[model samples]
Target: MRRAASMGMTTPTTPVAIDPADLAGVFDRYARDLLRYCTRRVGEQVAEDVVAETFLVAYERRDRYDASRGEVLPWLYGIATNLLRRHRRTEIRALRALAHADGGARAAEGPAQRATDRVDAERAVGRLSAVLAKLPRRQRDVLMLFAVAELEYAEIAEALQIPLGSVQSALHRARAKVRAALAEGDAR
Candidate 1:
């Protein structure tokens, strides 16, 4: 190495390369949750693709990630949420169908007491989806990231790249709409 005084100008240090281990850690921690969230939003068939693509995108952009800002799971979730947006119509249609399906006996759940619990759970999910489908896309996204993903308001704001106040406002509106819908359903 040349002496600083002799060289007059010190060469800049090389940029740090992203470690593969970091990405691996992210994948290990978040892949299952990402897949589950995607499946909930878009169904099982395309959830895998969405989650795979999410990790690929995260890996490619790993250098830009700011660990100081937040955790990897929210970032992965944001990516998965964006991918799910492309399949919104498919999700809405699928939810609509599910909401309307008669609680028929399934191959797995035989006509036992257990099936009753399963059917009740399915109906609850179906009703939730039917209500979710009616929400504005932005409001729905904010709601899901908060309610389904169980993210904090700050995390949702960071993940969605929106103001914290906007996240709050959207969540409030979405919750109100959902409560209204559920109440209306109860009356029926």
Candidate 2:
């Protein structure tokens, strides 16, 4: 007697074709990062809405995507950054929120930790936030892309439409200000 063959067995899996649905999945995967970036650049309250809008805009423009350019993260970042720039007031509000929240209950630390440590960390964050606010838009963008988004310099240059050298310079300047602020706090 011959053994029964499997009815649904396949030789090998074929590469699935990419469609709008696949593109949507990509958007979903990157949405959290985009939202975080927007929240940092703008405010948490507006971040969800802004990130939704950004994905919508990206979806509309997806056909223009070039496969030769590699992954879509940099492209998404560029789009989000542009949207962030258009809403400067929202960005200011976000920074203000950071300042206000810095002094309040800590998120990661326990409630019973040393008060002095909390105060020192809060003060440092506040001073850094103030200095960050005073930076030029380009510098701030570079700093955020580097420190927060954790993108490489080339990726940041692509996202911000700046030269690699400019990315380096902006980061250097932002770092200098942050260091100076921390040092000043130390002296005091």
Candidate 3:
């Protein structure tokens, strides 16, 4: 410890190792974040499956985790991302279903806005979901990682195995497209 301190070396914040058999601890630590990200990506329909498969893959490949790259959270996210790829059609279908379903109409049932405003707001939201469904896969993934997963740029880059600049570029393009779509929708 004295030798390390003499060299100005410091301990890392996150743990660099875990017992493979103690995966329950890992799951308890990260399942909520995974659930939220998965749910946002694929909706409640199959988010559980994605999260479960991610953990299963992680447990199966526990030895492959390189702590030097980053934390366990991002590693788990990377696994979840791979699983999400297989569910791309599921995501698109869910988004389109939301766009067409009246399930959320009651969510805006509050009397805050008049009937037309409520209808317009609902329509605008539907348009937004449709636009999200239409975003290119990489753009959508980057957007969801940043927006829903709340992963930092470097974390997202690590999770997706992309360059940091790619993460930034993809996020920029996604936000611009979403803004443009929303603006157009509002103008209607």
Specify the highest-lDDT model's number. 3
lDDT of 1 by residue, 136-167 (tens): 98898899888778888887887887899999
Give the Å error, residue 161, model 2.
1.9
How far is 62's C-alpha from truth in model 2 (Å)? 1.3
Q: Where does candidate 1 stray beyond 4 Å?
A: 1-18, 104-120
- For every model shown, the clashing-pair count is 0, 0, 0
* Candidate 2 TM-score versus the reference: 0.78
Question: Each prediction's Cα lDDT score?
Answer: 0.75, 0.72, 0.79
The global Cα lDDT (0 to 1) of model 3 is: 0.79
Comparing 1 and 3 by lDDT, which wins?
A: 3
RMSD of 2: 9.3
- Ten-residue region with minimum lDDT total, candidate 1: 1-10
Candidates ranked by lDDT: 3, 1, 2
Per residue, candidate 3 scores C-alpha lDDT tens digits across 1-188 of: 01212222222554344446557867876898999999988887699999999999988886666544446777788889889989999989988986785635665565655566566677776787888899998899889888888888988888998999999999999999999998886787
C-alpha lDDT of residue 162 in model 2: 85
